[model samples]
Target: MRIRRAGADDAGALALAGAATFLETFAGILHGRDIVEHCRKQHAPQVYADWLDDAGAALWLAETAEGAAPVGYAVIAPPKLPLHDLSEDDLELKRIYLLSRFHGGGVGRELMEQAVAEARVRGARRLLLGVYAGNTRALAFYARNGFEHVGERRFQVGGNTYGDAILALDLRR
Candidate 1:
């Protein structure tokens, strides 16, 4: 797979990829319109486009060997809402999604590597991410990547409330 930084032109493609991966991954857990409604707000092309315009935001896309559409993506930026009192050197891994076919094939790992490296390059001391508390797979993935549970937060998707574990990795380490 190949990875690259995204620009404004990639907004639509990124939105589709984000929505697809999110729906596919959460289909079993989230039911019906809940998933659609969440994706509508979170994965809209305008959302990504606006972020692309932000100097503080960075986005990366991963493509398969076939070089078709992107299969996964990652975003790192200053936290929209700091979980607590964040210093200037903290960045949040806003989102990372991969199609099911790419799971366990190192796609996610590559994305993580790029995101963490970018975070450090931008002089961030800590990298924080929020993952569904019940998502054992993602929690394990973050743990393997040297992230530790720092706290928990309530994540609302549509009308549903989900517990999300806040994980953090110290870049200085």
Candidate 2:
């Protein structure tokens, strides 16, 4: 697989991969209707397009080596979480997802490395992210990467609200 910077033209692929991964990850854990509604809006191509247009945002897409089909993506942007201690030099790992089939193959790690490198290049001191509080696997993954739980917030999905754990990794480490 190859991970590359994503542009506005990649909105569709990003949307597809984003929606697919979201659904795949939350299908059994979250309410089906909530999953559908959440993906519909959160993973829309227009959303990605808008992010692409933002000067402070960056996205990377992971694609298969053979057919170049998008399999995963990661996005980093100016802090949007509800952290009161956020600083101008901080960034958020707004999203990072990969198809389940590609798990454990190092693609996720590559995506994460790309995000961290980009954040450092942009002079960010800390990188934050929010994850479903109940997602043990994801939480463990983040912990392994040196992220520590720092806060919590309510995440809205469709008409439902869920708890989210905020994690932060100090780039100065």
Candidate number of the best lDDT: 2
Tens-place lDDT per residue, model 2, 1-173, is 89999997999999999999999999888899999999999999999999999999999999999999999999999998998898999999999999989999999999999999999999999999999999999999899899999999999988889999999999998
After superposition, which runs of candidate 2 have C-alpha atoms over 4 Å from their true positions? none
**Model 1 per-residue lDDT tens digits across residues 37-104:** 99999999999998899999999988866856788899988875436767788999999999988899
**How does each model score on lDDT?**
0.89, 0.96
Please give the lDDT score for candidate 2. 0.96
Q: In terms of TM-score, how similar is model 2 to the real structure?
A: 0.98
Top-TM-score candidate index: 2
Model 1: residue 67 alpha-carbon error in angstroms: 4.1
- TM-score attained by model 1: 0.95
User: Could you tell me how far off, in angstroms, the CA of residue 55 lies in candidate 1 after the best superposition?
Assistant: 0.9
What's the number of clashes in each of the models? 0, 0
For model 1 the local lDDT of residue 79 reads 73
